[model samples]
Target: MSNTAGRIEPAITDIEQLKDHPAMARLLSWKRDAITEAKFDRDELTITIDRAFIRDACNILKPEFNFLSDVTSVDWLPSEPRFQVTYHLLSHKLKERVRLRVMLPGGQPTVESIISVWPAANFFEREIHDLMGIRFIGHPNMTRILMPDDWEGHPLRKDYPVEGYR
Candidate 1:
């Protein structure tokens, strides 16, 4: 978390520079088939993809992004796909980072696990599965990491009671 070493030299300082990169070209090719939306702010890129294609996207991006910084989820109660699971990735060599997002229906929201793509996703996926009730299919061990196994409902859901569960 601390960049105390010094200002890290940025790779691909201008987002525009990504246009010609092979990895970027491959990623963009899926824009219509897999990617739903893409947004860039400051120097970071956030792309929304169909949950079914997450693995393919990660594979395409693996050459440029070698690190998975974090995986988390957001619950949007009234939204069509009520859960938005996000993956944060960092490229040490490229010195760049990007975010990938997938939306799932509120009813038993589920998506494939990325642990196969990045082993580090184990704990993070478990955490999201625990707190958000967003199942990660194909996860090696999908047990709850935070809440008790017997807990009634996901605590991070927008509808969860603010009061402590009795």
Candidate 2:
């Protein structure tokens, strides 16, 4: 139904085949340990990881799959785990995507920094640490990026009640 190089032609399919890729297998098994639910879209895979697996998983993902993307966190109050950290990873060359997430309770929340794997994350990680109070151990420059260095508490924490919002 479309024009080709010289004559009318049909749209050819470009669905690349995916076989038994070990990275996927390992990721799936890891997800099973913590994920309550999971689903995979054609182009992206979203897996919820346990807090324990976060550091270890990112270590493997960055090097093995060349994943370089944003890492951010969200505050989910009234939820068992008070925080949700999201990692978005993509490989343009391979046209693949992986989204990894971790949940942390309010009392003591921390995750290892991935700066060693992705230099760009140095600042991003710091920002999350500063604003969300999710400690990132081993961060070369774990300083406040958005908030003042001496800020008392993490602004994004759910329990950080506003002045009038009882």
- The best candidate by TM-score is 1
Error of 1 at 90 (Å): 0.4
Please provide, for model 2 over 1-166, each residue's C-alpha lDDT reduced to its tens digit, 9 standing for 90 to 100.
Answer: 5465665343322221221344456565555454443445554556667777677777666555676678999998887788888888876666667777887887778887777777877888888888788888879877888877777887776677766234
How many Å off is the CA of 21 in candidate 2?
A: 7.8
Clashing pairs in 1: none
- Using lDDT, give the best candidate's number: 1
How far out, in Å, is residue 22 in model 1?
7.1
Q: Which stretches of model 2 miss by more than 4 angstroms?
A: 1-23, 26-37, 41-43, 160-166
lDDT tens string, model 1, 50-84? 88999879988887798999999998889787899
lDDT of 2: 0.70
